[model samples]
Target chain A: MIRFDQVSKRYPGSDEALRNVSFEIAQGELAFVTGHSGAGKSTLLKLMAAIERPSAGTVLIGNQNVSKLRPRIVPYMRRKFGLVFQDHKLLYDRNCFENVALPLYINGVTGQEAAKRIRAALDKVGLLGKEKAMPITLSGGEQQRLAIARAVVSRPAILIADEPTGNLDETYAAEIMALFHAFRQVGVTVIIATHDAHGISNIPGKMLHLDHGRLTVS
Target chain B: MKHWINQHTLVWRLVLARTCRNKLATLLIWTVIGIALCLPALLYVIIDNLNQLAGEVKHEPQISIFMKLDADKTIVDTTKSRLEKHAGIGSLQFVSKDSAWKQMQDDALTDNIATNLKQNPLPDAFFIQPKDHAPTAIEQLQHELQNWEGIEHVLADADWAKRLYSILELGKKAVWVLSGLLGFALVTIIGNTIRLQILTQREEIEVSKLIGATDGFIRRPFLYAGALYGFGGSLVALALINGIITIFNLSVADLAELYGSSFILALPGWQISLGITACAVTLGWLGSYIAVNRSLARLNPH
Candidate 1:
C-alpha cells in the first residue's frame, strides 16, 4: 500500500512541484495519475518511489516513512517499486536479455534462475524471441515493451511508469496497457502517469487528476 | 552465501567483458602503470643484489691488537689467551715480536729498513677476526681491545666496508622513497581511469540507480576493472624487471669472468613479488573506490 498525507515538494529558484497532496491506493490496485505536463504527476510518483523527498509531508510506502528514510536505506527501499521511464531508459549497449536482467542482478538474482525469470518477463512483453537483439536495433514499440519487461523482471510489488506510452502509436499503447492489465490481474499494483485520456478511457481504474501542482480529482 | 558469491561472480564476469571490449585502452593503461611501478622495483632489485655482493666480498672484518714494546713472552701468552677467550673474536693468530721482526727482514721491501734497526723494534701483535662483520660491532670490539692491559693500540681497517654499508643504506632509502611516490602515481592513474569509465557509463549508472541498483552494485564492475588493471600492470612490471635482470646478468657474467669471479644476479624472491602484487591490487581497489564514491555522491546529490 502507498499513502501520502499533505505532501509538498519545492525546488530552489522555482515554484512548488507538489502542493499539499494527499492520496492513498490500496495494495494490488491499478491506478492512473492523469495530469498535463508539469502538473505534479511525475513529482508524486518520484515521492512514492522515494527517489526525491517531499519538502513537507509524510509519504509512506507500506509502513516506512519514505521522506524520513535514511539515505543509506533508500536504495533497498526503492527495490519495492519497478520504474519505467518516459524514454524507456534501457541500456542500449547491451542486448534485450541483459537489459531485462539488470533489476534481477541488482536483487542478487543470476545464472539459470535469473535467465528463467528474464525469459518469462520478456515473453510477457512479447519480446521473448529477441532476447539477443540490441535495443538500438529494436523498433520504438519493441524498445518500450523491452523496458516494460525490464521493469517487471524483478517482480517488484509496485510498478511505476512515467509516461510509458508517451511516444507509442495507438496500437502499441493499447498493447502496453494490456500488459499492465495482465500484471494487475496477477495482484501487481500498477501506477501510470499520462495525459492520454482517450487511450485509458476503456480501462477501469482509480484516477488522480492533477492541475498546477494540486490534486484536482480523485 | 551462495547468492552472495553468485553476485560477485556475475559482477566479475561483467567487468571482464567490459574490459575486453576496450582491449587497446586497457592494455595501454596497464603498460603505463607497469612502467611506473617498474622504475622502483628495478631499483630495489639492483640495491638488493649490490648488498649481496658486498656481503660476499667481505667475509669478516679483522682487528689487529699490538702489544707494548716492553711486554714480554708471559704478557704475550696472557694476551693471546684473553683474545682467544673473547666471544667477539672468531679466530686469533699471535705473532711474537722476534718472528715479526724476522718476517719483516725476510720481506725484500722491508728487509733493508729492518736491517737498519739495531734491535727488533716490532711489537708483539694479535690478529683477530671478529665473529660479527657489522661496522658498529667491529668498532665496538676494537674499542674493547684498546682498553685491555699492556695493549698499545687496536687497529681495524673496516672503513671501506663501513662506507659501502652506508651507501647501501642510502640506496635502500631511495628505493623506499621512489616506491612511495610511484605507488601514489599508480593510485592516481587508476583513479583517473575509473573516473573516465564512470563518465562513459553515466547513462547506465543513472538508469541502474533509478531501477533500484545500489551504489555498491553500480560500483562493483568499476572496482573490479581497476583491480584487474593493477594486477595486470604489476605482472608486466615483474616481467620487465626479470627481463632487465636477465640482460644485465649476461654482461655481468662476462665482467665477472674477466675478474676471475663468478657472480649472477638473483631474481626477486617470492615475498617481494607477492608484496608488489598485493600493494598494486590494494591501490587499484582504493583508486576505484574513491573515484566511484565521488561520482556517486555528485550524481545523487542529497
Candidate 2:
C-alpha cells in the first residue's frame, strides 16, 4: 500500500508539476491515474518511486515515508516496488531472460534458484519461449510483458507502470492489463498512470484523475 | 569465504564483459591513461641515467686550488708543471692572474672594486685534477696537493655536486608522488563516467533494485569496467614508453659509448609492475563502488 499526503512537485525553471495532491492506494488494489499529457501523471509516479521528492508533504510507501528516508536506504525502499516506465526501459542489448534475471542477480539469487525463478517469470509473462530473444525482436506486447515480468520477478509487493500499454495495440493493451490484474489478484498492488480512456475503462478499479497538477477522485 | 569470493568474481566478470563489449571506448580511455602514465616512466629513465652519470663522475679526480696574491708568474708557472706530475694527477690547469681577471670579467659584477683596477690584481693559482673524484679518493688527493711546496691551499669541490645530487633526488621523489596523484585522478574519471552511465539507466537500476538485487551485485560490471580500463591503459602506456625508449636508444647508445657505459630503457622491474596492477585494480574497485553507491542511492524501490 502507498499514500501521498498533500504532495507537490516543482521542477527547476517550471511551475509545479503536482500541487498538494493526496491519495492512498489499497493493498492488492489495481488502479489507474488518468490524465492528459502534462497532467502530473509522471510526476506522481516518480514521487511514488522516490526518484523525485515532494516539494511539500509526505510520500509513504508501506508505512515508511520514502521522501524522508535517508539517501542510502532508497535502494532498499526501491527493492519493495517494481517500476516500469512507458518506454518499457528494457536494456535492449540484453535478452529477455537476462533483463528479467537482472534484479535476481543484483539480489545475489544466482545458480539454480535464479534459473528457476527467471524461468517462472518468463513463463508467467508467456515469454517462456522468448527467454533468449532480445526486446527488439519481441513484439510490442511481448516487450511490455517482459518489462512486467522483470518488475514482478523478484516479487515486489507494489508494481508501478507508466503507460505500459501506450504503444501496444488494443488487444495487447488489454492483455497487459490482464497480467497486472492477475498480479493484483495475488495481493500485489498495481498503479498504472495513463491518459487512455479505452485502456482503463473496463478495468475494475478506482480511477484517479489529475487536472492542472490537482488530483481528484472520479 | 569461497562463496563470497565467487559472488565477487561474478561481479568482476560482469564488469569485464561490459568492458569487452565496448572495446573501442576502452581503447580510447586506455590511450588517455597511457599518455598520462608515460610521463612518469620517462622521468624514471632520466633519473636512473642521471644516477649512472653521477656514478661515473665519482671516479673522476676533483681538487680546488686557493691563490697567493703576491706569487711570481715565473714561480707559479713552474709550480703548475710540478703539480701536474704529482702521483694522483690525471690532469691539471693553472688559474693565472690574467685568467682570474678574465673569469671576474665574465662574472661581470659591475660597480665593484675589480672594475677600478688597471692591471689584474688577482693571485695566480693551480686547479688540481685528480685520478679519482670519489669523496675518499678526492680527500687523499687533496692531502697530497696540500703537501706540495707552492700549493697555497688544497680543497675538494663538494658544495656544487652535492647540491645538484640533492635536486636530482627531489626529482626522483616527485615522480612517485605525481604518479600516485595521476592514478587517483584516473579513478575519479572512471568513476564519474560509470556513474553517468548508471544514472542514464536509472529505470533499469530501479527495476533491478526492486527485484532484490544488492548494491554490490548491481555494481559488479561497472567496477570490472574500471579495472579493465586501468589494466589496459597500463599495458598501452608501457608499450608507448617502450617505443619511446627504442627511439631514444639510438642517441643514448652513441652518448653512452662515448662515456664507456651501456644502458637500456625498460619498464619498472616486475615488482613495480605488480604495484601498477594493484593500483589499477584498486582504482577500478573504488570507482565502481562510488558509481554504484550514488546511483543506487537515487533509485527508490518501495
Candidate 3:
C-alpha cells in the first residue's frame, strides 16, 4: 500500500515539480501514473521509492513515514520497492545473471539460494536462456526485461517504474505491461509512470492523471 | 552469521578478481609500499645490532682511583674503607705501590723501565667496578671518588662507550622519524590509488546505490583491496629486507673474522615482522576507508 498526502516538491532555482498532490493505492493493486513530459511523474515515483524527500507533506508506505525516515535507514527502506528505470540502469559489462544478481547481492543473499531465485526471476521475464549473455549484447527489449528481472529478484512488495517502456516499441511495451499484470496477480503492488495513455487503455487498473504538476483526475 | 560471512567472502572474491584484472598496477603499488617500508626496517635492524654490540662492550664500566705518591699506609687504609662503604662501588681491589712495581718489573713489556727506576715510583690504586654501567652514572661516581682524601685522580674508562651510545641514540631517533614519514607517504599512495579505483568504478557504485545497496556494502570491496595491497607489500618488504641482510651477512662475516669477532647481522624476529605487517595493513585500510567514504558522500548527497 502507498499513500501521498498533499505532497509538494520544488527544486532550488526551478519551478515546482509537483504541488499539493495526494493519492492512495490499496494492496495488490496495479496503478498507472499518466502525465505528459515535465508533469511530475518521475518526481512522484522517486518520492514513493524514498529516493527524494517531499518538500512539503508526507509520503507513507505501509504505515511508515518515508519523508521522516533517517538517511541511515533509507537504503533498507528502499529495499521494500523494486525500481525499474527508463534507461534500464543495467551494468553492461556484466552478464544478464550478474545484472539480476545485483539486488540479491545488496540484500546479502548469495550462494546456490541466490542463484535459484535469480534464475526464477529471469525465467519470469523470459530471459532464462540469456543468463550468461552480456547486457550490451542483448536486444533493447531483452535489456529492458533484464532490468525488470533485476528489480523483481529481491521480491519487493511494491514495484515502481519511471517510464518502464519509454524506449520500447508497442509490442515490447505490451509484453512489459503483461509482466506487471502477472506481478499484480501474485499480490505485488505495481505503479508505473508513463506519458503514453493508449498503452494501458485495455488493461484494467486504476489511473491517476497529472497535468502541469497538478493532479487533475484519479 | 552465515549470511554475513557469505557477504564478506563474496566481497573478498570480488576484490581478488579486480586485483587480478589489474596485475601491473597492483604489482607497482606493492613495490612502492615495499620499498617505503623496507627503508625504515633496514635502518632499525642495523641500529638494533649496534645497540647489542654496545651492550656487550659497556657491561660493567670500571673506575681507577690512584692515590697520591706521598700518601702513607694509613691513608691507603682510609681510602679503601671509604670505597668499601660506597654504594656505587660494586667491587674493588687494592694494588699497593710496592707490588705494582714488583709486577711491572716481572712483566716483559715494562721490565726495562722498572729495572732502571731507583725507587718504586708507582702509586697505590684501587680498581673499582661501578654498580651502574651507564656512562653518566660511572662519570658521577668517578667525580665523587676524585674528591676523596689522599686520592690523586679518578679515571672512568666509559668515554668511548658514551660516544657510541649517543650515536646509537641518534640512529634510533632517525629510524623513528623516517618510519613516520614513510608511513604517511604509504597512506597517501594507497588513498590516491583507491580514489582512482572509485572513479573508474563510478558507474557500478551509482547503480549499486540506486538498487538499495548500503554504503557499507559498497565500501567493503575497496577496503579489502587496499588491505590486500598492504599485505602483499609487507611481504615484499620483508623478503627484500631478509635478502639484503643475507647478502650483507656474507660480507659481515668476513669483516668480523678480520677483526677476530663472529658478530653477524640477525634478521628481525617474528614479533617485529608481524608488527610491520599489521601496521601496513592498518594503513591500507585507513587509506581506503577515507577515500571511499569521501566519494560515497559526494555520490549520494542525500
Candidate 4:
C-alpha cells in the first residue's frame, strides 16, 4: 500500500514539482498515474521510492513514512519496490543475464541458486533465450522486458514504472501492460507513471490524473 | 554462513572484474604507487643496516688517558683509583713509561726514536675502554676525564663514530620527512585513480543505488580494488628493496674486505616489511574511501 498526503516537492530555485498532491493505492492494486509532461508524475514515483524527498509532505508505504527515511535507510526501503525506468538503464557491457541478475546479486544471491532465480525471472519476461545476448543487440521491446526481469528478480512487493512503454509500438506497449497485469494478479502492487492515458484506457486499473503538479483525479 | 561467503565472493569477483576492465590503467596506477612507496622502504632498509654498522663500531671504541709528565706515584695511584670508580670506564690497563718506551722499540718505525730519546718522553697513561662506544657516551666520558687531577689529556678514537652517528641522525630525519611526503603522494595517487573509476562507472553506480544497493555495497568493490592496488604495490616495493639488497650482497665482499669487516647487506626485517605493507594498504583504503564518499554524496539517488 502507498499513500501520499499533501506531499509537495520543490527543487531548489524552482517551483514545486508536486504541489500538495495526495493519493493512495490499496494493497495488491495496480494504478496508472496519467499526467502531461512536467505534471509531477515522475516526481510522484520518485517520492514513493524516497529518491526525492517531499518539500512538505507525508509519503507513506505500508506503515513506514518513506518521505522521512534517512539516506542510509533509503536502499533498504527501495528493496520493497521493483522500479523500472523509461531508458531501461541496463548495463550495455554486460549480457542480458548479468543485467537481469543485478538485483539478486545486490541482495547477496549467487551460485546455482542465484542462477536459478535469474533464469526464472528472465523466463517470466520472455527473455530466457536472450540471456547471453548483450542489451545493445536486443530490440527496444526486448530491452524493456529485460529491465522488467531485473526489477522483479528480487520479488519486491511493490512494482513502480516510469514510462514502462515510452519507446515501444502499440502492440509492445499493450504487451508491457499485460505483463503488469500478470504481476498484479499475483498480488503485487503496481503503479506506473505514463503521459499516455489512452494507451491503458482499456486495462482494468485505477487511474490517477495529475495536472499542473496537482492531483486532478484519483 | 553461506550467504556471507556468497556476498564476499561476489564483491571480490566484481573487484577483479572492474580491475581487469582497464588493465593498462590499473597497471599504471599500481606501478606509480610501487615506485612511490619503494623510496621510503629502501631508506628504511638502509637505516637498519647503518644501525648494525654502528653497533659493530661500538665494540671497537678505545681511548687513552695520558697523565702529566710531572705527576708522581701518588698522582698515578689517585688517578687509577678515580678511573676504576668511573661509570663509563668498562676496563682499564695502566701503561708505564718504561713499557711505553719498550713498545716503541719493538716497532720498526719508532725503534730509532726510542734509542734517540735519552729519557722516556711518554707519560704514564691508562688504556681505557668505555661501557658503551656510542659517540655521545664516549664524548661524555672524554669530557668527564679531562678535568681529572694529574691528567694531561683524554684522547678517544671516536671521531669517525661521532661523524657516522651524526650522519645517521640526519638520515633518520630525512626518512621521516620522506615518509610523510610519499604518504601524501600515495594517497593522492590512489585517490585520483578511484575518482576516475567512479566517474567511469557512474551509470552503473547510479543504477545500483536505485535497485536497493546500499552505499556500503556499492563502495565495497571499489575499496577492495584500491586495497589490492596498494597491497600489490607494496609487495612490489618490498621486492625492489630485496632485489637491491641481493645485488648489493653480491658486491659487498670487496667493500667488506677493504674495511676489515664481513658484514653483508641484509634484507629489511619482518617488522619493517609488515609496517610498509600495512601503511600502504591503509593509505589505499583511506584514499578510496574519500573518493568514493565524495562522489557518492554528489550523486543524489533520491
Question: What C-alpha root-mean-square deviation, in Å, does candidate 1 show against the real structure?
Answer: 5.3
Cα-lDDT of candidate 1: 0.90
The TM-scores of all predictions, comma-separated, are 0.85, 0.71, 0.88, 0.89
TM-score, model 3 to reference: 0.88
Candidate 1 local lDDT, residue B290:
92
Candidate lDDT (C-alpha), each: 0.90, 0.78, 0.92, 0.89
Q: Mind giving the per-residue lDDT tens digits that candidate 3 earns over A25-138?
A: 999999999999999999999889988899999999999998889988989999999999989888877899999999999999999999999999999999999999999998
Cα lDDT, model 1, residue B63: 82
Counting clashing residue pairs in each candidate, in order, gives: 0, 11, 0, 2
Ranking by DockQ: 4, 3, 1, 2
**Model 4 fnat value:** 0.83
lDDT per residue, candidate 3, B155-201, as tens digits? Answer: 98767777888899999999999999999999899999999999988
User: What range of 10 consecutive residues in model 2 chain A has the weakest lDDT sum?
Assistant: A102-111
Give me the displacement of residue A28 in model 1, in angstroms.
2.0
Q: Judged by DockQ, which candidate is best?
A: 4
Model 1, which residues run further than 4 Å from truth? B56-93, B96-156
Question: For residues B1-302, could you state the per-residue lDDT of candidate 2 as single tens digits?
Answer: 64467567777776677777778877887888777777776687678767776766553445778656676666677777777666777777767778678888777454266677787766676666776657777777777667766667777876467766887899899898987888778778778777877876676665565444556666766777777777877787778877887888888888878877686554466765566666666776687678777776666333
Write one digit per residue (lDDT tens) for candidate 1, span A24-44: 999999999999999988888
Give the lowest summed-lDDT range of ten residues in model 1 chain B: B55-64
Off by over 4 Å in 3: B59-61, B66-91, B95-125, B129-154
Candidate 2, true inter-chain contacts retained: 0.38
Q: Which has the greatest lDDT?
A: 3
Q: How many angstroms is residue B251 displaced in model 4 relative to the true structure, after the best TM-score fit?
A: 4.5
Writing each residue's lDDT as its tens digit, candidate 4 over A1-218 gives 89989988899999878898888899999899998999988989888877878889799999899866777888888888899997889999799999988888788888898899999999999989999999999899999999999999999999999999998999999999999999999999999999987889898898999998999888
